[model samples]
Structures are given as C-alpha cells and as structure tokens.
Target chain A: MAEMNRFTRDHEWARRDGELVRVGISDYAQDALGDIVFVELPQPGRRVAAGEAVAEVESTKTVSSVMAPVAGEVVEVNAALASQPETINRDPFAAGWLFALRPVRVAELDDLLDETEYRKYVEELSR
Target chain B: MLRTPLFGAHEHLKARLTEFAGWEMPLSYSGVAAEHRAVRESSGVFDLCHMGRLVLEGTGVAPVLERLAPSRIATLRPGRARYTVILNGDGGIVDDVIVTRESDTRYHLCVNAVNRERVVDLLRKTADGGDTRVADLTLETAQIAVQGPDSAELVRPLLAGADFPAYMHTVRGEWEGQEIVVSRTGYTGELGVELFLPAAAAPSLWQRLVEEAVPCGLGARDTLRLEAGYPLYGHELTESVTPVAAGIGWVVDWSRSDLPARARLERDRKAPEQLLCGFSLSAPGVPRDGFPVFLDGRSVGVVTSGNMGISVGHGIGMTWLPAAHTDPGNAIEIEIRGRRIPAVVEQPPFYTRGTVRQSVD
Candidate 1:
C-alpha cells in the first residue's frame, strides 16, 4: 500500500516517500485562501523545525505562511510554482507538492494527525 | 460585525465573508479571479450598501457643501454628479466622494464607509448656523452596482419608465413597484449603474440582478478598481495625503472664488513634491502596499496600492514617487519580500479595454 498522508493543525500535509517526505498545504487550506498568486519556497538545504514557517503563499486578498509539519532539511522544492502558483489552488495534492524534506527525527511523523482525523478537524473548523 | 440589507442573499450564494469597515461583507462568491473576469468580459453585480449615503437639503445646502468640499457645488445642475474630495483646512483629503445634485435645494453625498461618521459630523458642523439640514440615510438605504459591457442591457429590463441616466447623471425611477434612485456611476471601469432603494427591498433586487449578472465580492471590487487606477480612501487618500500628490488635483475647482483649500492646493499644484504614478512590474512578484520603491538601488517612495491585475495579466500598482520620476517609461524597482523586482512607470488606467465611456442610446 502507498504511504498514508498526515496533517498538522496549521493545514500542512506530509507523506513519506522512501527516505524523503513530500509536503504541501491541504485542500481545505487552499480553498479558504481563495486564489494563490505567488508562492515563496524555502531554498534547498535550509533546515526547518516543526511549526516553523517554511514558505509564504500570497493570494489576491492576503498573504499566509505555510508551516513545516515536522523538523527537516529541505532537499528539493517545486520550481514550477514560481511561474504558475495557481497549480496549488487547482490541485493541492500530487503535482502541487511544495517540497521534499529529509526528516531529522522520523518519529516526529507520529505527532501529525491522520487523514481521517484531519477531515474531522476541518469539518469542525467550518462550524 | 454589522450585516448589510443583502446579507441573506450573500449567505444564500455561499459567499466567503470577511469583515470590512465593521461590516460582514462578501469577499468572494465563486472566486476572485473568476468574478473579476466576469466584470471585465460581461456583467457583474456588487453589494455596496456598506458605503455611506447622506442627504443635505434646504436653500443654503449648496453653499454649505461648497464651503466644506474642494469641488464647486454651486455650478452642479440637478441630475448631475461630480466626483470630489472633502478636505481639511490644511489641504489633506478627509474623504473622496461623489456628490449628486438631486435637486436645486437637495444633494446626495456618497462617502466612504470608514469615514462616514467623520463626514457627517463635518457637514453638520458646517451647517450649524444655516438653514441646511443634514440626514444620514445609510442605514435606511441599500446600494448595488451592476457593471460591465452588458450592464445597460442587464438593467434596462428592470427600469419601468425612466430612461437610463447618462454617464455622471442620476434618475429616479420605479422598479418592481418600488422607487429607487439610479446613478450612472461606478468604481469599476465599466459602463454601469448604481441603484439606491429601501433597505427592505435590497434582497429581492439583489436576487434579480444575480440572475443575470455574476455576483462579485469585495475581492473582485479591489482588483477592478486597481485596474481602473481609482484610489481607495484609506490606501491612497489618507488624512495626510493631499489630492495634489494623489494625482486628483483636477477635481479641485480653482475657478470657484470661495472654494476651501484652494490656496494650499494652488501652492502644491505649482510644485508637488511627490505625486502618484502607476507601475507595471516586469518581474514575477506582486507588489503590495507600503513596499519600498527604489531607483538606482536607493529607496525613493512606497507603493500605496498594488495587485495582480487580472485584466492586465501582470502585476500593476500605484505608488507615490518623486515628481521628477513620474514620467512614463522611467525605470523603477519595488522590493517585495526582500526581492527587488524591476518595474516601469506607466500612465493609467492600467487596463484600457474597459467600456466606461461607451455611448448608450
């Protein structure tokens, strides 16, 4: 079976792929943000701690930070976002993945909520 | 947060609501980009009840308004409207407004929402010893705008007998057996009309318009106005920014002998230190308010308002630059998020394909 995705309260999602982890904002977050105009990603090799802001997403109305779900060093970023940021709004998963990271502590993944729990959290937020 | 008369309509449309000027207003119904394109291409409707409306009447009303506003009111004929600015004694702008001459003795003033109370107090104080009476009609009235290339067609069916008002004109007419005041004026750079009716009638009227026009929200309104190069009161026309520096000096009636702020405006007109100019970013990043503008790596000014203009297909903004650098084609740079992006000074309306001045039969 494929790796299951986990989410943070800040709306970031992380999915392990072999030795690296792929991260991006959840669909719920992108819909709330309206349209994504620009995305500023962290440079490769930059280390980030859990809950630390690793990227900035600007919409027509406002700008919001995308926090890291787990402590890791960025290994690769979505270069295509600089030219077309709306991909995130169109598809918040798969092709719109923000970056790949090598986690400092693999056990930190357990701290994030599972997909089922994330759905519940988002439903409660809408209330 | 305060809700407008059409709050139920917005809720029914499943619009995303945001607090603006203490009112719970729609930020977007479908999406900002889609709503913006709808206005540019066809038709869009907006709920503008958050804007303040006030009426001043009596024989002395014209003179009282003339004394308080930078624009000459005595020359405005009935059924006509003039976009003017209210100014402080020191020549700073209090609010940018559209004053419509309803009759020889009565005038309707449309002021910004945030500055509503301040404008009302100023008008009341100026009319203190005169026969003029000021009344705040904001809460009792509801306002909506239908804008785009097809605006006239979209609104004509609803208007019973009164002809569509000419541009910059107002006409009173009956719609669905209720009276309303329609003005051929709007913030978007499109052929449009604004309807003012009883607060209770707003929801139904909104539903009628939305059936034919896209329901736009504040997000689209901002982008549309930015493309038109119109200034928002708080962003571009602050208490400290004069109309001269804001590039709205033409609104001042210099020929009027008794106009307020004339002397100061005249002085600034001769040598405006900083004036508003438009910039189109050649780089990728979007410029935002308060972003530092540079020339030759030295900071020269700051952006007053900026956005990714959907019609222009690039980042465009207005900035208060030194008068020396206001010429179109001048090279400039805006620092957005620690990146100095290349930009060029340009004249506005940034998007020229608008139908604002299209002739109506």
Candidate 2:
C-alpha cells in the first residue's frame, strides 16, 4: 500500500503506483473550490501532454480544470466521482483519486514537490 | 471595506470573508451546500446590513414616493409593505425595492446596497423643497434575516410575546429595551422575519439567534434567492432593462398616466420582442452569467443570473429570449465551455415548495 506522492503548482497530486501514476487534486484545491457538484474525467487510453487540462470540476459557483502533471496516457478513470463528486471535498487523497496514467517519462515526478515541500508551498500561498 | 455590526461575530466563528458591494461579508461558515440545505429543511440566519435602508417622513412623503416607485404608494396602509421598483425616464429599472408604510407620515425603503447612493440622491432631488425629509439609516442600523420552516418558532420568544407580523407586514418590538422592527419578508423563499435594530445592539442579538439557527452567509443567500426565482439588481435588472422585459411588468401601475417611464413601458407592453425567461438544464452543467444562449442554431440571449439549483437538483438560470421562445416548455440550448447544453424554458421558483406565504398563526 506504500505509494510516493508528488505535487504540482496547479494544485494536482500524483501518486506513484507500480508503473502507473494516480492523479487527484490536493486538499487545498478542493477547499478553495468549495462544494463540488460535478466532475468530468479524461477517458481511458487518451494521450495528454504535461499541463494539459484533462478533467473539469464544477463547484456550486465556479468551474475548475484538473491538468495533467506530466505527459502520459490515461490508463484508468474514477467513475465513482461522476455520482459522488463531493468525495473529492471529503477525501481528496485515497477514495477520491481521479485517474491513473502510465507516465511516458517517470523522471518528471522528480521535478514535482514532495510532502514537506508541498505543505510549505501551500503555507506560503496563503500568506 | 465597510463592515457590518455582525462582522465581529462572523470573525469569532472563523467565517471565510469576501468583499461584496463595498462591504467585508462572510461568504460561508461550514460550507455552501450545508447552509443552503439548513435553510430549506430547518432554519438559518443572515446579516443583511449591506442592504440599504432609507426613511422618509412628512405628510407629503406618500406623494413623493408614489411618483418615484412603480407600486401604489399613496394607497398603501400603515404596517403594510409592497415589493416594487424604481425606474428611469425610459421605463428601465433603476432598482427593485421594498416600500413599507410604517405610519401616515413615515415610510421605509429597503434597497440594494450597490444602488443605495443613486436611489437616495434621486429621492432627495425629487422631494426637494417639499415637506418630506429623507434620511439614510443603513450605517446606523443592523438588518438580520432569520429564515426557514422553523424560523418563526425560533424567533418568536426573542420578541417577548409580540404577535408575529403577517407576510409583507411589519411590527415594532423591543429587545433589552432597544426598539427593533420585525418584518415578515426575506430574499430566501421561506417563512422568515427580518429584524432591524440599532447597530450597537445587533451583535448581542445575533449571537443569541445564531445559537438556535445555522449562521448562513452570502453564498447560500445567492443560491436560495436564485432557486426562489427572485431577481438580483445588477443581474436581472439594470438601467437598460425595463420591467416589461424583465418579467415584472405587473408591478407597474399602468392606470397612473404620470407614472415614471410611462411612455417606454406602454411601448414595450404593446410589443415585447424579447422577454426574460427561466430555464433548467436537461444535462449536467452549471450555467453562469454572461454565457450565451442559443435556439435552433441561432444565438438568442445570455444568462442574466445562473447557479446550481441545490434544492431542485439541477442547473437553473435566467435569460432574455425572443417572446416566441420564452414559453414554459420551449426548448433551448446554453453554451458552456464551448459545449451546448440542452435545456428547457420553464417558469421559475425552480424550487416550488417555498413556505413564503404560509401562515405563522
């Protein structure tokens, strides 16, 4: 069950799971977006470039995009979120995982922030 | 930013504050969805001090207000209130207001915060040299709205045996020897009362009330009003939008030949090409202000106000469309993020089970 997690400046999170990387938004992103009502996930087998918007999250008042952290092909998508979008607000890390991707360049995860670095980044953002 | 008397209470509860109409107001407490549901099922409270309150006093006050507002002011009996609008020369809406006749010579006006100054200025100029005296009470008073099904039972004990006012009526009461005005009106379509009291005593009363009701914020207020199909000033109404086109032509007293914007209203009533209408999405998506609407491959209008109708469990919005396409069951499309969302034109109050006129007796 051990998985290494990394963060993006756009507030998305990537967890290293075997040869696949699981993606979801950070807790900060969900809190800032407020109660999510709907979510659209990228289709499995869809190829996307780094920083490309692959998902759309709709809250009560506004809509936000979830971007790909690195270039990859979507291997799995979270269909549960289509009916229970609030899961992202309730638990953004485990049960709320958005989609999984097979990374074309695994080295890109090294450039992302770790747990400690991401916490500090979010702290600085508020101040 | 200006702060309401309840600002300290909001800070104490750690509410997320946002700037609204020159005031620092609470956007949410626990969450938007939670607060919205609280008002629908139970009870919730709000600090509405950002709304403007004006007082006009004198025997001549009724005539001045009659000419300025679209509703019949001179015929309004004391203790009664009416929802009406102020208009410009072209019959365009200046602002939507609530006019309450407190007494023979005293009248109260509740207006939107954004148009407070303009409305006050307009009233002053219109009553110049007359016996009427105009006063702005917004900063000196605190307005608190307690709404929902249980609102009456929750607030009745605070007023010390004072009989509850009927809907759109007002009664004067006292809290700790300080005079407070209680009116049966609210933006949320619920059985509620709005209290007006001196600014200094508001925080204490608000603390007592919040203990029994959920402390709601502007986020829930917007959704509740939108679900009730009420129009917001800057959105559904503006200087360029007439009552006829805004689906509020009934407020105008057409029999009065000297009514403001008579010429323009008469013309629009005769032939209204475009009318404001309500729609609900057939698919999943949230329509928002300024998003273009389409009918049969042609762009017709744009959303005036839009939101997720939490109680109705769908996306509902308002838009101006051709009169032919504005009927209750007509089909239309709304473009969101480059996708056309299928929708149907439906009469609003999207959440129709409101207790707004339910008897509190």
Model 2 whole-model lDDT (C-alpha atoms): 0.91
Writing each residue's lDDT as its tens digit, candidate 2 over B1-361 gives 9999999999999998999999999999988999999999999999999999999999889888777777789888998989999887677888999999999899999999999999999999889889999999999999999999999998887666778889999888787788899999999999999998999999999998989899999999999999999989999999897887888888888888678777778777888878889999999888999999999989988999998888898889999998878889899999999999999999978999999899977
TM-score, candidate number 2? 0.98
DockQ of each: 0.67, 0.74
Q: What DockQ does candidate 2 score?
A: 0.74
lDDT of 1: 0.90
Worst 10 residues of 2 chain B by lDDT: B154-163
Lowest-scoring 10 consecutive residues by lDDT in candidate 1 chain B?
Answer: B156-165
**On residues B185-209, what C-alpha lDDT tens digit does candidate 1 reach at each position?**
9988999999999998888889989
lDDT of 1 by residue, A1-127 (tens): 9999999999999999888889999999899888888888999999999889999888887788888888999999999998788899998988788998899987789989999999999999989
**Alpha-carbon local distance difference test for all models:** 0.90, 0.91
Task: Give the runs in model 2 whose Cα sits over 4 Å from its true position.
Answer: none
